[model samples]
Target: MKKFICIISAAVACIACESRTYEEISDNTPIAQVVTYNKDVKAIIDANCVSCHSPGPQALTNYSQVKGNINSIIDRISRANGDPQKMPQGGSLSPAQINIITKWKTDGLPEN
Candidate 1:
């Protein structure tokens, strides 16, 4: 009887220690710097998107092209990053790369 009680108590204690879904996990993670067009956006575009999207049907190489088609850029980013129709033909871009493009579009697609 005493062994049973001890086992039950231990089980209850373990169960109590288990994390609850309602408990919020603190996001102490530092916020990453936003990606800008001149610095980060161009690289991502050049590496992943520009092959098919530059000076052709898509054309996302320069600021003018990207800025002019900001909406399309955003749509493609969202789809490629979030949904199933990702760009770059084969693989997906990293979160950091995606963030850079997203930030650039959100920041008015600056020239510099």
Candidate 2:
């Protein structure tokens, strides 16, 4: 019983020590320069997403695949509630990274 109590106490302590990382941005926040597949988009996806979605039949590791799924990509990265899952599952992208991606899409998912 005491061991169980100690484990519960430790779990509570860990939970209490955890901090929220989600940063809220105001509507007026300016976005960065246009992001392109070769320059920024690919790296961000590779670093955060391809691990799970790649080396598979529908890999997100290439331009064609990514271009085909641009809307879904943006939706997932932005952590939209509509998705069945939030990507980079255990972690999250920084607001800047998300901004880069959002801008990339708005800029038409350019190859450059």
Candidate 3:
């Protein structure tokens, strides 16, 4: 009975200690500098999204396209790795990378 109580207590402690999501973590992280499209977001998009989304119905080859699709971009990128609608298809972007893009938007979508 003592062992069972200990195990149940441990299980409850573990269950109560929930980890933060990337968005939550990012929200608490402070940005030391401004985030911009040319310097920050373009590289991430080029490396992750351009190949499939460019020269097609929903292109993201340039700033205008990217800025125009910012809402969808955020939604797709925010999806979990295995989610069918997640951007970058087979993989997920790091929290830092995602944070950079999110910061770019929060910074008013600066091109430079």
Candidate 4:
């Protein structure tokens, strides 16, 4: 019984010591998919990106206007993580959202 308790305790300790990586934590989780201006990306952008990137001759409102500038968006997101030109200005986007955007850009910015 003592040996069994020790083995169980060791197992618990090993499990407790195991740490999940950021990718592991963020991977396979259900997040908004934006394969080209879909609802998920739209919602994120609407709440975070549109305020600064919208269009109107002097503005660039809506997803359609921004969708054409996929490279710029990806660059902005890449630099935004630690820069002032970041989306939403002060708020932070989830890693999952960022990953989705990055993946979308990598996948050729499809309009699906």
Best by TM-score: 3
lDDT of 1 by residue, 1-112 (tens): 9999999999999989977432135333333665567777777778888888857867888877877877766666556444666566666666555556666766666667
The global Cα lDDT (0 to 1) of model 2 is: 0.80
Q: Name the 10 consecutive residues with the lowest summed lDDT in model 4.
A: 55-64
Error of 1 at 48 (Å): 0.7
Q: Judged by lDDT against the true structure, how good is candidate 3?
A: 0.89
For residues 2-103, could you state the per-residue lDDT of candidate 2 as single tens digits? 999999999999999977545654243556576789998889889988988878775898998888988877777777544557777877777778888788
TM per candidate comes to 0.58, 0.67, 0.73, 0.56
Backbone clashes under 3 angstroms, per model: 1, 0, 0, 7
**Candidate 4 off by > 4 Å:** 1-34, 57-60, 80-82
Which window of ten consecutive residues has the lowest lDDT sum in model 3? 22-31
RMSD per prediction, one decimal? Answer: 6.2, 8.5, 4.6, 4.7
Reference-based lDDT, residue 89, model 2? 83
> Judged by lDDT against the true structure, how good is candidate 1?
0.68
Q: Is 2 or 3 the stronger prediction by lDDT?
A: 3
In order, candidate lDDTs are 0.68, 0.80, 0.89, 0.66
